[model samples]
Target: MKILTIDTGTTNTRITLWRDGKAVSVAATQVGVRDTAITGSRSKLDEAVRDTIAAALEKGRTTADDVDLVLASGMITSNVGLHEIPHVLAPAGIADLARGMESELLPHIFSKPIWFVPGVRNDVENIGLHNCEEMDMMRGEEVEVMGLIERLSLRGPAMLIMPGSHSKFVCIDENNQITGCVTTLSGELLHIITHNTILADSLDRDFATEINPEMLLAGAELAKRIGLGRACFNVRTLDQFTIYQRNDRANFLLGAVLGADLLTLKNSNAIRMRPGIDVIIAGKPILKQALALLVQNDDYFSGDVTVVPDDLQPQLAGLGAIAVARARKLVTP
Candidate 1:
């Protein structure tokens, strides 16, 4: 089966074509659900998606008729996207995710069927006492996690960490089921603190260049020593003391924020106790910082840490797998 998957996120949209369990073609654009929904008209969003799909089909050398199935995940199913599909509760497996998918015909774009996969939700009960039973929801990362499990042939419990504007830590069991998940606003918070606050003036450096690993590790260690509250202020203090260069300051800031995130995860009772934990860090093009922190803070987790660069294959595999499961009548709606 030829499957096309569209993964729309907060700032970008990606389309990947899959055949026989591999990605044949992939395309990406800056038009995300949030980027196109300025007017609140569903028609406008649909039109944008149609245009992207048209472009992708041309680039992939495949017409609409050539595709057997079209699957969409990420914020595309949000209230601001094409439509809002309610989230499927956690402990979800392929069958649960497949059953939650909603199909619709876009005659304006193609005759082929399009399915929107619903997001996954985990209630507060599974997260432990500090949360007091609040709910967490994710749209795009679940599909990637599912695909990674199958591609990596991971048959045991594993922790999948997807870092982005908002990060997700998903836990899967031996049965290849999502047992629970946690979301952190660390990325967003970092942006706000560095770009929107007065602290921005203290650090002016190009982030595209290679980050200093030493400064990054030092920042992580500093956060661990004094906690984030004081560590955040330490960035400014370093500026006053002229202790670090401009680029070094930026690296320190990155380390401090990532360190705080690691500290929170390390302190979590659920994370500390998970058996035979295998860590997979996906997404985020620059992974040196995250990997360093993970390796440095080995006290919280004792397992192999694998880094998988963010690509189009995992999303394609995930969408295709769910579609196959549905086609075989393995999932109930």
Candidate 2:
């Protein structure tokens, strides 16, 4: 069976085509939609979505009619997306997300049957820490995380951290059920402080910023002591004197923010690991480094840690996972 999956995120739109459960082609495009705060960008968003899907289809030498199933997740269903499908609360799984898609209101541009996966939400005490209400509505990465977990056959009490603009830590039980999770705005926060805020001018554009270990460690320590807001101020001050010139400074700042996030998880007692337990880190390389630092922290180290580079075509992983769910009748066609 041929399946096409789309993952429309804030920064980009990605599509992947799968043949008999293996990815054959994939494509991505920068999002043209601006002002995601309103519905006016819907036209542009729809265009971007179609363009990405069309490109993927072309690369795979297939047409929409050739696709046996279509699946999608991400902001595509938010008010800012092509549709405004509401979120289904947790511990709702893929089944609930698929069911929600059946009733989802979509724009006329989509002629194929598309399944929109809904994010999980809860109002628990930790909700305030990560804005659970907001994080409650994840899109494409949820399936990717679940797929990676299943692919690894990870068993019993696993913690999966997916880092990006909005990082998330998802806890799974032995049955691959999501029991609890937390989200952090570390990526977006870093972007804002370094680019849009006062620190932009001082940042060395050419510096291999991600690998600067000194900056990572400093960032971690600063965040541990002064907190995120104050940490930003410190970066700005150091930038003035070229203190940030030391490659280590940037690494510290990065580490500080990530460490703070890990600290929150630690406080919540969310880092549980038994014998043969696994920690799956999924995301871009820089964020992966931050996660690696966390895993190496003496306070948190227990089980084996495995970092999975996001697959060449993450949308395929997501789509394949959904396909598995559908084949098992966990979700309706």
TM-scores for candidates 1 onward, in order = 0.84, 0.82
Question: Which segments of candidate 2 are over 4 A away from where they belong?
Answer: 32-36, 39-41, 94-108, 123-135, 205-215, 236-246, 268-278, 310-313, 324-333
| Maximum-TM-score candidate | 1
> Residue-wise lDDT of candidate 2 within 1-333, one digit each (tens)?
887777777778778888876789989988833436545657677777777888999999998788777777777767677666666665645455556664332445456767666655543445565543434445555576557755665564777778777887777676665666677798877677656765566555222245665566676777788787787567667766664573455565577678877776665443333334567787787778677765666355577687775554255346535654574464455
Q: Write the per-residue lDDT of candidate 1 for residues 224-303, one digit (tens) a residue.
A: 89887677777788889876877777777778778777765655543332534877777766644455454545576787
- The Cα local distance difference test for each model comes to 0.71, 0.65
- Compute the lDDT of residue 20 as modeled in candidate 2: 76
Window of ten residues with lowest summed lDDT in model 2:
268-277
Q: What lDDT score is found at residue 234 in candidate 1?
A: 76
- Global local distance difference test of model 1: 0.71
